[model samples]
Target: MTRGTGRGGSSAAARSVDVARLAGVSQKTVSRVFNDEPYVSSDVRRRVLEAAGQLGYRRNNAARALASGRTRSIGVVTLGTALYGPASLLMGVERIVRDTGYALRVVNTMEGDAAGVAGAVGSLLDQGVDGIVISEPIDEAGDGVDAPLRVDVPVLVIGAPSPVTAPTVLTAGDGADLMARAATEHLLALGHATVHHLAGPQGWYAARDRLEGWRATLTAHGRDVPPVVTGDWSAASGYRAGRELAADPDVTAVFAANDDMAIGLIRALAEAGRRVPQDVSVVGFDDVPVAAYVTPPLTTVRQLFDAVAQEGLKRLVHTIENPDADPLPSSGPPVDLVIRASTAPPPSRTTPARGRRPASPSPADTPRPPLTNGGPAGDH
Candidate 1:
């Protein structure tokens, strides 16, 4: 037999004709199955799919786009870093986009500021994507020179709401302010007179939101808000901030913006001979995979990234299909606070005199009960 005449072979490449012939159906039926058009019976759809698989048939996306006058693809712009938040958001977008039978093209800003973001979006436009999603746009350099992105295509932003005219979606339900408030209040509820914050870098919208949340909670409760120590969302930065906090005897409780920084802060406290939940307590944001398995399980706020991605994708697709309809801003997904072993009431005694070391707490003084699953001890 000739090469093209074999059981699953074709003259050139497998096409709808081959699928239809092998499945004993008309070419139109095969087309309906591939296009997901209604009216194809279940048995015929299953037969067409099975035959396509057997014949190694792949849909001609380019041809479909040309005929339909639409590119079934989306462009995603995000930060270059592999930080958990950005990475997770990208994964979620990819999954949802694929489920909806669209292709995803991604561009990274390579740690640049607003200019980099503008460039990334421009590149996606050149590639002819149906829609664009900007994940975690940062204003690090703070040079307001970059103009707002102007695009004819639908645009969705995944970070904090911006001045850009595009409809924005927050990945977290409560935004940073509420999350920070929740974390700080958790520490205060444990009887810590005040809460110190180790914030994320200034450029990140997430960082700023968290700081705002922490400050607002402190102010509302009439608690002292210490000077903010900023970190690049890295454990090393947290360690550095922790070392400085370790020196101050007045430091009783700390809230790091992410779990990596929290881990670093805990290590620094340990090195300085301060026991967690004894001499000091630490809480972190982002309940990362290792948060629960750490030496002292982290008390953290968990944002539902998958839910955010799904909701954002749904909204973007709706906008793409109904261009004339007004796009409603989404409030995003809510966050949960998971109370673990890493926090407790402040030391029983007042802050020791500046230079004098505080007495170590006895076992009785540090009563660490089993960690609670998902609620704060009380309203701050």
Candidate 2:
């Protein structure tokens, strides 16, 4: 046995046969003992164990994993898009996995379809994975897709909007609600007549939450709640919605469902000769990478999506590893309003639509309630 740093902090010299000589055994016997191969007598095994302990020997895990089928690895299935949220989450998970003596194998599954995800998991199981992770939120698809709720081993669901019934982690709520409330509240704070919304697809969880927030806020403030104008989560749809809203001339403050729609809204407003922050104020959600880089630098809700993703991953991993452990407490991320060059007071010429009964504000508008561990996706 020898101990000291050498090249790359290895042995100070080549392993000497002194331990074998001291233990009164052949060097091959010493090697077999280290390998834990059978057939060595109990006495010789005891002698070899003592000698190795004195030598300060450390078994190399990488070499051992190579020889043994156990890799202590977890497989992660992700949406291949590498969008902001998913991409950021991967970084966070890697940071933790690096030190845990566990390996992570990433498999890209497109849009988290049931088949794609299941196949990815199947591949990992074939590779002798100890556990698996699914990083799809079932976003805006409104639980429209199918997926496995259980697996033979642990299955962690990350990037989910609510805590999944099976072991999982997720963002606080549908998130769109917070964003909608913030955007509308910001406008109300500015003393706009009422805030109008250009919504995303109805099936999307985000779209539904945002609309709910808008309605709840309006109904609480003694304001009229107008019907939501639909969008396909695209700039074009928002542009179309904007054109119609612009026709009214009273759509003073508008909250588009996301930044991309906000861009379209701005373009439509400008096309109609309406000036931003002067004629119409628009607020958007997500504050995507391009939000600030746009022409006027959008005023939007700034969500810690990457942080959300990272936290969700952590929670899912914990739940997967120890399902019986106490549930984690949420840090409760705040949704902030970014006051940029885009939002301002309403135009003087704006007029209210006639004959609509005004709505009274509710608790969802002011002192808004937080999403309280809304149990997992599909529970609804």
Candidate 3:
């Protein structure tokens, strides 16, 4: 019957009223802090938490659920993969959710899992989460399945379109296209006549977005859009594409869908005696940790996983708290193009033809200022 006992029903545990008394605040304020309700000042919240910690007080989530009809927990549906992008995003979500005072329940769906997103949602619903976050969902049906997915809780889909027909479908962190555009544009700005693309598999929405952005950039700039070479978001796939590309002298610059592919492409190019930034330039997405320490250093678009997760979760929590209000408008993720030593102006074209030309000066040969076009830059 006592608060802060959760479902244990302990009579001796410290209650919210005790915390409020110790923190020199009203019991109402203590409830607001524990419930994660908005409008509580940071100082008051901190004081209440300190008092609760001192007294070893905890929230009676079961009682609170009965009173407010909310479990105060969130469910996350993500692809069960070790890929850098998805894994990093899930970690960010985990970190931010803890700060929101909501218990997290994650359900990962594998590549061939039956019902994929729908099944994941059903499982989470059964567990009774207040909200759901679908992070980086791949296109399961490939050709766009027409069936609508049903979900009752507030849904936040990140980095992909919402597959569900929930009452509150909030979408955020779908800026891969914009970042891809920036990467492609960066190579083009460096004087490559037309940049080649090493695209990821089309199944992933992120990959499709990157491919779309690359194609759109070339089209908008009036450059020749080369035929796309698809990779499997792996170094080996990139190496294969690179081997094919290396045979053609026309491949001056390549915008890979991800950093691993770009690194593999560079290795393949090196084996073929095609010097990077001298004979060819390369740009990639997701500036991974080792991007800077590679042989030539990779120029890449930095994906802000933490920032995206933080922003998206904030909006999700807001929707959970205020059911009637419209979902907040996203200001869009910040685009960061990290300039390293791997990109440079194309080699000189003596004959003005599409054949193999002499190697030009590398981008590192001259001291150039940090270059940025569409968005922010993190020059190395």
Best model number under lDDT: 3
> How well does model 1 score by local distance difference test?
0.79
> After TM-score superposition, what is the CA distance of residue 333 in candidate 1 from its true location, in Å?
2.2
> Highest TM-score: which candidate?
3
TM-scores of the models, in the order given? 0.81, 0.65, 0.88
Expressed as tens digits, the lDDT of each residue in 29-48 for candidate 3 is: 99989877889999999999
- lDDT tens digits, residue span 1-380, model 2: 33734336556433426457657899889777765577999999999777656655544545556776456687877668644445655666666565444678988876535466557777887887766666654452446454434556655555344222343333433355766887888887766889888987664455777888999889899998876788876788888888898888777889888777889988998999877767788888876777776767787876665566555555655654456886566676567666666765555533235675534333343232232211221121
Query: What is the Cα-based lDDT of residue 307 in candidate 3?
Result: 91
Report the lDDT tens digits of candidate 1 across residue range 1-380: 11134373435577889889999999999988987788999999999999888777878888889997779899998888889988887888899999877889999887755467778888998999988888854774575554566777777778655424454332323366777787887787667889999999887888888999999999999988789999999999999999999999999999899999999999999999988877888889878888887877778887678888888888888788667786647763465778876886787653467798867555464443232245433221
Q: Rank the candidates by TM-score, best first.
A: 3, 1, 2
Model 2, residue 74: what's the lDDT? 75
| Model 2 stretches with alpha carbons more than 4 Å out | 1-5, 8-72, 82-102, 111-114, 128-131, 139-148, 152-174, 317-324, 349-380
Show model 3 residue runs off by greater than 4 Å: 1-12, 36-43, 349-380
Backbone collision count in every prediction? 2, 10, 0
Each candidate: RMSD to true structure?
A: 5.9, 11.6, 4.7
Clashing pairs in 2: 140-204, 140-205, 163-376, 164-376, 219-360, 219-361, 220-360, 220-361, 220-362, 221-361
